[model samples]
Target: MHIYSSHVLVCSGTSCTSKKSPELIKKLEEGIKRKKLDEKIQVITTSCFGLCAEGPIVVVYPEGAIYSNVTLNDIDEIINEHLVKGRIVKRLLSGNNEGNNSYESADFFKKQVRIALRNCGVINPEIIEEYIAYDGYQALGKVLTTMTPEQVIDKVLDSGLRGRGGAGFPTGRKWLFAANAKGDKKYVCCNADEGDPGAFMDRSILEGDPHSIIEAMAIAAYGIGSDQGYIYVRAEYPIAVKRLNIAIDQAKELGLLGDKIFGTDFSFNLELRLGAGAFVCGEETALMTSIEGKRGEPRPRPPFPANKGLFQKPTILNNVETLSNIPIIILKGADWFKTIGTKKSPGTKVFAIGGKINNTGLVEIPMGTTLREVIYDIGGGIPNGKKFKAAQTGGPSGGCIPTEHLDVPIEYDTLIELGSMMGSGGLIIMDEDNCMVDIAKFFLEFSVDESCGKCPPCRIGTKRMYGILKRITEGKGEEGDIETLEELAETIQAAALCGLGKTSPNPVLSTLRYFRHEYEEHIVNKKCSAGVCKELLDYIIIPNDCMGCTKCIKVCPTKAITGKIKEPHIIDQEECIKCGACLEACPFGAIIRK
Candidate 1:
C-alpha cells in the first residue's frame, strides 16, 4: 500500500465546486509536483464539510488543520508551509482561534452529530478504495452472511430510526410491510429526488458517499427478498448523478451488486431513473409514477407504496438520508443507534440552514435539538445584530416558527404540534426586518408554481391563497382576506388529493396562526411595519434630519424628490413608486420607511 507523509483534503461538493475548489485542486497538484513533494504528499477531493459558507475548504491531515475560503493563490503557501515545512498556516486556518483548528475543535461542527454525513469531507468519493478502507460495504457483507431477513428487519425496528425524508415514517415498518406483502417480485427503491428549496441533504450524500446508498439498498433488497432496485434522482444534480453512476459501476465490478453477491443465492441489480425537476415527484407515489415513465402526479392512497408500487409490485422506498443510515445500523447494532438520540425520535437529522443567519450551511443534529441551539449556537444567530423574528422550516409545504417557539424541540411531533413540520430539513431564519405576511406569501407563491394541477385543493385552492397573500402584500387586501385564507387552508388540508396538495396551505396557515397581527396590519392599517411591503410603505423625509442633501433626488428613478440645494427636500408622494431607491440614497437617515 502507498503511504503518504501528509494528505490534503479539498472539498469537491457543488457549493465548493462553484467557488473554484476544482481549480484550487489543480493548482495544489501542480505546486506539489513543482516543489518535488508529490511522492510524500497526497491531494484528494472529498465532499462538503457541512460548513458550506466557508468554502472552498482544504484540510491538511495528520494535523487536520482546516483552511476555509481557499483560493488559487493560497495553494503555494499550503503546499510549502504545511506540506513541506510542516508548519500550519495560521492565516488560512478556519475558526476564530489563533492557535489550532481541527474537525472536532471547530465551533460550527461542535453541535453537529454526523451519521449520514460521516464520510463527507473525509473520504475521496470517486475512489471506491477510500470508501472500502473505512468499512463501507462491511454492513452489506454482514447482512448477507450473518443475519437472516427477518432478523435484519427486526434489528431496524429495534433501532427506532425514523425516515429522514420529512414525513418521519418508521423505516423498519416500511421495510417489513414490503417484506410481508405477497408479491412474486418485490423491488427496493431510493428517493434521491430532493426538491425542497435550499435543501441538499440527499444530493450531498449521493455526491460524497454514493457507495453507502448502494450498500444500504442491497441490504434492503436482501431483507425484502428483492433482486431488482431503482434510484430516482433529479437530473439537475449532475455531480450527485455522476458520482452515483460511478459507485454503481464500481460495486458491480467488485461483485457487491449484480448476480449472486458473495457467491450466495441472492442476486440484485440496480438502475438509475432521472426526473425532469418536478417538485411534486418528491412524493412517494408520484416518484414511483415518474419512474414508470408516466407524468409525475400523486396517486390517492388506499394501497400505499409498500403493497403496490413501482409497476404494481410490492416495493419499499427510502430517501437518500434514510438509506445512508441502514448500513451503519447493521454494522453498529440497533442498541448503539438507539442510544444517540431521543427515545421517540432516534438518530440525527441533516438540516440545510440558510437565510439571515451568520453561518449559512448544512447541519446534522440530534432529532430533539432545540430551534434555539440550531439558530444561535450552530448558525451564529441572525446577521448584523438583527433580532431573530421567525424561522421557516420544511420549505413551502411546512410552516413558520415565530420567536415565541424558538425554544421548542425540533422533533417531528413537536414541529407538527407547533403547526410546522420536519419537511426535508430546510431551516430559513428571519430577522426583525422580515415581514411574516410577506414570508408566507413567498412560500405560497412557490407552492402555486410547483403545484401539478392534479387536484383542486392544490391547483385552485393554493392559487387562490397565493392571490390573497399577494393582494395583502401589495396594499390591495380586503378586510375579510384573513378569514378567507383560513377557510381556504382548512379546505385544502382536508380535501387535497395528496401530501403535496394537503400541505400546500401550511405556510399560509402557520403564519396566520402565529403572526396574524402582521396580516391585519397589512390589510387594515395599510402598513408594513417591517418595511418589506413596498406598496404599503410611504418613504417620508424627516424634515429635521434632512440636511438638504440632494442625494435622494439625484438617485430617484421616478424624480419624486425635489428641493433646492440648501433646503430640506419635498417628496412628491403621488409620483413616488415606492422602489426604496430614495431611501437607500439618503445619507443622513433622513428618509424613513413607514
Candidate 2:
C-alpha cells in the first residue's frame, strides 16, 4: 500500500463538476505525478463542500487549507506551492478573513452541524474503502451482528428523527408499520427523485456519500423485515446515478449487500431504478409506481407505502436525506442523536440555498436554527445590499416567509405554523425588489405545469387561480380576484388527490396570508410596488439626470421617446411596450420604473 503524508481533497459534486472541477483534478494529478511526489502525496476526489457559490473547492489535508473557485490556472500553483513546497497558497483561499483558511471557520460552514452531511466533502464516494475507513458500514454491521429488527426500529423511534423530505413524518413509525404489515413479500425503497426547484440536497448526498444510503437502506431492510430493495433516482442526475451504481456494486462485492449480509440469516438484495424526471415522483407512492414500470403518479393514501407499496407489497420508503441519518443514529445511539436539535424536530436539515443570497449553495444546520441565522449568518445575508423581503421554502408546494418571521426558529412545525412546510429543503431568499404577487405566481405556474392532471382540483383549479394572478400582474385584475384566489386555494387544498395536488396552492395561500396588501394593491390600484409586473410599470425619464441623449430614442423599438439634443427626453406611455430598451440604452441614471 502506498502511504502518503498529505492528501489533496477536490470536490467533484455536481455543482463543482459543472464548474470544471474534474479538469482541476486531472491537472493536479498529472502535475503531482510529474513532480515525482506521487509516493508522498495523494490526490482524492470527494463530494460537495456545501459552499457551491465558490465551487471547484480543494482542501489540503494535514493543513486543512481550503481554496475555492479553483481553476486550471490555479492548479499548478496549488501543486507547486502548497503540495510540494509545503507553503499555503494565500491567493486562492476562500473565506480567508484575518488569515483563516479552514472550511469550518468560514462563515458558510461555521455553525453547520453535519451529521447527514458528515462524509460528504470528506471521503472519496466511489471508493468503498474510504467509506469503510470513516466507520461507514459499522452501523449495518452492528445491526446485523448484534441487534434484532425490533430493537433497530425502537432505536430509530427513540431518536426522534423525522423525515427530511418535506412531509416530516416519523421515520421510525414508518419502519414499525412496515415491520408489522402482513406481507410475505416486502421491500425497502429510497426516494431520490428530488424535483424541487432550486433544490439539490438529495443529489449532493447521493453524489458525495452514496455508500451511506446503501448501508442505511440495508439497515432499513433489516429493521423492516425486507429482502428486496430499490433506489428510485432521477435520470437527470447523471453524475449521482453513476456514483450510486459504483457504490452499490462495491457494497455487493464486499458482502455488505445481497444475500446473507455479515454472515447472518438476514438476506437482502438491492436494485437501482431511474425516473423520467417527473416532479410528482418525489412523493413516495408516485416514486414506487414509477419503479413498477408505470406512469409516475401518486396513489391516494390509506394503503400507504408501509401497508402496500411497490408491486403490492408492504414497504418502507424514505428520502435520501432521511435515510442518510439512519447509520449515524445506529452507531451514535438514539440518546446521543436526540441531543442535537429541538425535541420535536431532532437532528440537522440540509437545505439548498438559492436566490438573492450572498452564499448560494447547500447548508446543513440544526433544526432549531432561526431563519435570521440561516439568511444572515450562514447565507451571508441578501446580495447587493438589498433588504430581505421574503423566503420561499418547499418549492412549488411551499409558502413564502415574510420579514416579520425572520427570527422564527426553522422547525418543521414552526414553518407550517407560519403557513409554510419544509418541502425538500429548498430555501430561496427574496430581496426587497421582488414583487410578492409575482413570486406567488411563479411557484403557482410551476405547480400548474408539474401537476399530474389526475385530480381535477389541482389541474383545473390551479389554472383558474393562476389566471387571476396573471390578470393582477398584468393590471387587468377585478375587485374580487384576491377573494377568488383564496377560494380556489382552499378548494384545492381540501380536494386534491395526492400530496402534489394537495399542497399545490401553498405558495398562493402563504403569500396571501402574509402579503395580502400586495395583492390588493395589484388589484385595486393597478400598481406593482416592486415594479416587477411590466404591464403595471411606466418608464419615466428623470429630467435632472437625462442629458437628452438620443440613446433612448435610438434604441426604442416603437420610437416612444422623443426629445431634442441636450434636453430632457419624454416617453409616450401609450407607445411604450415596457421592454425597457430605453432603460438599458440610457447611460445616465434617468429612467425610473413606477
- Badly placed stretches (over 4 Å) of model 2 are 1-100
Q: What is the TM-score of each candidate against the true structure?
A: 0.84, 0.84
Global CA lDDT computed for model 1: 0.91
Task: Please give, for residues 226-307, the per-residue lDDT of candidate 2 as tens digits.
Answer: 9988999999999999999999899989998888888899888889999988888888888888899999888888888888
The whole-model lDDT of each prediction reads 0.91, 0.92
Residues 332-408 of candidate 1: C-alpha lDDT, one tens digit per residue: 99999988878888999999999999999999998889999999999998889999988999998899999889888
Best by lDDT: 2
- On the 0 to 100 scale, the lDDT of residue 308 in model 2 is 91
Residue 555, candidate 2: Cα error in Å is 1.0
